[model samples]
Target chain A: MSAREISRLVVPNRGQSVWLVLLSASAMAFLAVFALALSVTSAQLARNWSAALAQTATVRISAPPEEIEAQTAIVLEVLRTTPGIAEANVMVAAEQAALLEAWLGPDLPLDALPLPRLIELTETEEGPDRQGLRLRLAAEAPGAVFDDHTRWRRPLAEAAGRLRAFALVSLGLIGGVTAAIVVLASSAALASNGQVIRVLRLVGARDRFIALAFVRRISSRAFIGAAAGTALGMLALRALPEAGGNVHLLSGLGFSGAGWLLPLAIPPLAMVLAWAASMATAFKLLREVT
Target chain B: MIAFEDVAHDYGGGPLFREVSVRLEPGSFHFLTGPSGAGKSTFLKLCYGELLPSFGVVRLMDRDVRTLSRDALAETRERIGVVHQDCQFLDHLSVEQNVGLPLTATGRPLREADLSDLLGWVGLGEQAEALPPTLSGGERQRAALARAIIAAPNVLLADEPTGNLDWEMSQRLMMLMIELNRMGTAVLIATHDLQLIRFAKAQVNARVMRIAGRRLQIAGADL
Candidate 1:
């Protein structure tokens, strides 16, 4: 039908559960935004952690204060001479104290503690062979232990990957729930308007024609409600404190730059979902009644 | 053009009508009359493809009704107009919109002048902006008639169009049907109102059929 003509046959909205559809769509969109944000942020964190830690290793030398300098120099010599070692440097006392402050508080007496001297190692593209490096450090620099940080970093990266997956699964569940709610609401609407459908059919209205009236009504509502929810979600995300200097998961639970555009698509997707739900329900009901 | 070939319809309990053979040719006018609960409405439904015959084939526009798909059935319905006994309407809509629904369904453009003329002809011009529920019994029937013929269907099937109207209103409705038939549109009206049938026969050469004892038969010149 012509747009003007179809507009005249407004689906009767009285007593139909339209509010349920709107509320469900809004709630779904709201949760979808957060899920998307969480997924994006976790993905970024996983990438960053994996990239930063993959090509780096640490050497800790523990010995008497008089022997610490000699052991550190010997560990650096061994690392520098290694085949896959790109660069190796001994960390200054101040740098070691700053790293230790995060764990032992700022007021700890660094002078009296028997701290281990640290050597940072950067690997080439082929990376340092862990087995060879460990054997070399044990033979030449017995006081030094090679640490790849994989014992803890790998688990952290895996946890970030799992969080991203969980967020994606939550998003899918939200979409499925939204569709189910819309189906129920549209079915209720079709049932309540049984007489109206009969009249339309009697006047030679096709099933598609009758279905368009209802689909348009419900999809428009979903679009409006989803738009509102998306806007609110974006605002809520924007109001959160910036990640700043923190290195934790909760601090990174937000979007940045082009990532904001992802949530903008929710409204249109909700509109399409609502249209399909209403169209299917309307045609099914019309078939039984006509 | 609607044709029934020894069609039989049953409601699972028993057969409501059997061996009902009839043909509605182009430009013909027919009146279906019978006593209460004699399956007049069922016969009308069969003619409009609303109910499938249980035993034999029914043809609409020369195609067997059984083979017509859902979309095909809808397309066939566009060529036929039906009015029910109670005059069903989307009560939320105004009378003007309700009358123009056929054009809307068929995707035909609405012309203000044509709609105004049709409403004026049905004597519902004054109630054009009023809702269907706000209209009187006669006005609702007239509006229903206006909607039925808005697309200019080849055949019109109305079940008890005057069942709820007064004597004056019944005559008025019959006159509208006669006017439509005079314009070469086939009309089949199912009703028990013999007086209305007699009034229509005076204005048009109408064939009268009656359903009795679960069968349909052409009525003689008794009335």
Candidate 2:
């Protein structure tokens, strides 16, 4: 029969099972969209954190008040002669006080505290070897210590990677649950419409024809439900707080630019999943009953 | 198109019928008469490949029913139409769609002119748009008959086709079957209504078989 005619043979199924499939698919798709967004956002955060923290180091010199300026000059001279060092500048006393303002209260007595002098270093694309730079600093300036910030960068990147992994796992679980729900609904539809099936079989309908009849109905429902859920999810993400400098993880959990197109694939994927689940379920039931 | 060779069905209990051999030739008409629970329905089911025999073989369209795959069995059934006791139908579909299902379900085009003529032949022209649930007993029976012969099957098997209709309706349906038989389609009607059988025998060459004591026997001239 023509596809249009085959679709016209849609059995009148129970309303409860229909709603079960639609609601479950919608709920699962909504969750999947959120997981997708979180995965994308966390990946972006990880890249940003790694890129900003890499190729930078700090030099701290602890010496007598009279010798602090001389050591700073020596460190700058050594850094300029280094092959991969792009620039080196000693941090002013005011910049050091602002860095400590978050931990120590504002307006601290910097001169009385005898704080260490700090020098900031920016490296070229091919950064200086850490061991070579440390050796040279120690020989030229005895009290100078080179800190490359690897200890701080590793932990932040690891956390973002874990978050992205968790989000991906969540998306997989949602897909599995959606497929299970569709299978249950298909079984219920086939079981409840026994009379319709008998009539169709009596008229010489192949199992394939009967299976297609139910598959089309179920997959279309899943597609529509997933579409609506995806739309709602995108809207919810759009309403979230915007990402900016110093944004926390949860505050900026959304997609930007071309990333919005990713969630649109969810509805089609859900439709294909529902089709496969319902087709398998229908054929199984037809075989058992026959 | 259907042949039974020493067929027997057990159905988990003792055998309902055994050693029944018969063949439905082209352009032949048959009536099966027996008491309640005498395996009349089972015999009809076996004709359409619905049930496999326990002891012997049943062949449809010259192919063994046991060896045919599910798809092959369905293809065999397309050449053999059947009407049930309750006249099953897809309640969601209209009377016309249900009538034309044999053609449409098999991927054949259902010509509107032929469907209208067939519906009118069965006297259901006015109720073409109605649903099966709204149809009366006689209308349902006529609709079922229309669906059966819509594909122009080689053999037509019916079980208790007129059990719920009045005498006039039964005779009307019997006439349609006789006309179909005249057009070279084999007809088999399983019913305990002996009067209907006698009525059919007068107009066409119909053989009457009775299931008694778990065996099929040709009835004598008692009727």
Candidate 3:
């Protein structure tokens, strides 16, 4: 047989450490897949929330019932003449009632409640100058209030950003824990296989040869385990409920078309982690020998 | 070749042996005999560079052992074969793999024909597929010998290679060593078996040395 083949076969394959590394890598990879999915999904949500709200505003007019129609007409005229306003239309009674149905209930009494008339505005890509639009509205119509939804957009964007950051942090933690587990498993394997080291050293085996034996075995095990974990994680993600047009955050917690390829990288990354950890541990343990 | 120049070794309490100077030239056969706890095995260890002399320089392959780096020491050891007293083997591996270790461990390709002939020569051809734990005492010693010489080292150091074997088995192992020495490999065997030493001396011109009084003494020709 070849030397490399023999060196690889020297270390006995049966031990507690083998299973320890396999299971730890699998669990870590599984968690990593979740973190990756979260990050990807949150990034999509952040972009969607920011873009959806960025170029839109709403003007709510509150006046006596007799002046409501007059103020609403004046607000529509002012918005039409505005520089960045792309489209402006008064929200219909049914549309207004539908918006309120979530909070109040079905068949909202639009006539009974003294609700203000709401004018929805969609701006061009450049967006209307909110300060100037507000000044014009205050002068033209005393009851007309122009709101660019800046208050709502800022907080939603920040929340999505924080969620993405949290997912990244989780990924880093998973990698660190995987490395630690691999190192511990490697150390235990070396310590328990003292006889193997002695026999190999007695046969004039170099440290590199001996280290590669353990590193190859341990890292390959990690790769196999992580692959299985990643597969299961992808299946779980695919099983999640699909998010249609609804902007619910947790509804679509999985990858879309191209995003499915991202989780495939996790298993190879785990293999690399195991390789580095076990190689370092093996060299350190061999140095302590002769 | 291994040479010791005024080497003294102490295990931190005091000197186990001191003022020892010896040289094992190529093709020379030497038997080291001493009672238990007389530092015979320690002397063998020094010869193979497993332990450094505390008070003197020990050289292997014409270089100071202390100056050689860890990897360099391993490379030096590839040229010197050692059969430990306990007949250590990787118990998980079969006898054939254990015998082929010196060549394979050193990154040298092992030929099947050569390994088969060597195993047959050592009377272990039938036990090649067996594990170390399943082998008899004599078989283990033979396997250890086969592993030590698989790389064709310049020198072979055996510490009690025949310590646990019967008279016939000991003679058989000694004859193998004698044959290897005839092939120009220096042989050094450390044991308390005087009869084995006498037997080896009859077959070949061998020098017998005794370790006593914390020193190495060349025995007279009476035995």
Candidate 4:
């Protein structure tokens, strides 16, 4: 077929169906992009939490006011002298008060609050094993209790890991749905154009030529639709406010780093979908006719 | 050329015909005349590779019909043109577009003026852009003829070329057929009109073949 002839069929008849596909694809792209963003964000957060808690330990000492300062100093001295000890600092009164502000209101009078003396322990690159350090800390600083942030960090990291897994699962489902929709649309077109096939066949056209007409028509439309959809999705992502900005909740949903490259694939993916769908539909219909 | 030897055919165990043998030579015209139910259409279909014989072989252009691939058969069909009585068409297309269908289908370059020329030969140049639904019976027959020969096929098989035309109209169509024969295109027309055959015999060396009792024989003696 000539360029004029190809345009005559592909351009005119695609009004409603192409619109439907574009609308569906845009919606799917929006969800799909968000799903990928969430997956990456969750994995990043999980990794950050895991690494931060792996080496650090906090010792909270509770004693009489006269002995509290001395006990904290003793704990810091023991940590600094220990093997794999990088540095140890006795947390000041103000530092302890700032830490309490997260749990209680900052305006609360420190005189009225029974806060413990806080001591920070940092490990070197050759950090001591957490199990061995815990035993040593208990023996040297009997009044001191160590908190590795393990109790809080484990569940938080696990939840983020699961969320990333869930987003990946959702992406898989979207891809499956996209393939299924294209197949159905292609099959319907084949059924409606039955006479076109017969006429072409009678005039010495092989099945490949007839199938190519349909494939070219559908694949180009799908490519256009998906490109438009991906553009819209990227635009929506751009319109979104940054994290810690006015729209605090939605800010976490944008692509980062190499993630922006994923949306660029939608158009080609849709082209493949059209080719697979139309070819399968054409050959299946041909079997019925011949 | 098409040859069928000891060909047997049956339509679902009904109206079976056996041991039918015949040969169609190049540049020769044949008329398949018989009663309405004598498998005349079936015989025509077999000659054109539409139906396969039950027991024997059918050779269209020297190749076994059963062994021809779909594309090969499609290429074979390009050499053979068939015009059914109904003259079905895409109603959305104009008369000229309908006539140039064979050219478009086979990837031939379509000339705009050639469409008008074909319509002119059929006396339908004035109705070039008219849709098929608007054409009269005589006009549709002419359009069908224009469609059949647009690709200049070697064989033209028309089933009832003038079934609904008046005496004058039938003569017009017959003249066109005779003109095509003169141009070395073999024509096979199937009809029950004995009068049309008599009119055709005057202009050319035509032969009358009767299809009766599930057999074929030449019979111009009665006329």
DockQ of each: 0.63, 0.68, 0.81, 0.36
Model 1, runs deviating above 4 Å: A1-8, A64-66, A83-86, A124-126, A245-247
**Candidate 1 local lDDT, A88-184, one digit each (tens):** 8888889999998999999999989888888888889998889988999899878899998898688978899899999999999988898888888
Root-mean-square deviation per candidate: 2.0, 1.5, 1.7, 4.1
Query: Compared with the true structure, what per-residue lDDT tens digits does model 3 show for residues A126-229?
Result: 88888999999999999999888889988988899999999999999999999999999999989888888888888888899889889988999999999989
lDDT of 4 by residue, B83-131 (tens): 7787777666678877777777566777878877878999998999899
lDDT of 4 at A274: 68
Regions of model 3 farther than 4 Å from truth: none
Error of 4 at A262 (Å): 3.3
lDDT of 4 by residue, A110-204 (tens): 86777787777777878756677677767776777878788989898888889889989988887777777666766766677666665566555
- lDDT value, candidate 4, whole model: 0.76
Ranking by TM-score: 2, 3, 1, 4
Please report, in order, the local distance difference test score of every candidate based on alpha carbons.
0.86, 0.90, 0.90, 0.76
Over the full model, what C-alpha lDDT does candidate 1 score relative to the true structure? 0.86
> What is the DockQ of the complex in model 3?
0.81
Candidate No. with top DockQ: 3
Backbone clash pairs for candidate 2 read: A1-B107
Which portions of model 4 miss their true places by more than 4 Å? A1-71, A74-90, A96-100, A106-132, A142-154, A224-241, A245-250, A256-261, B13-16, B47-50, B93-100, B108-120, B123-131, B208-210, B216-223
Model 1, residue B177: distance off in Å is 0.8
Question: Could you give the candidate ranking by DockQ, starting with the highest?
Answer: 3, 2, 1, 4
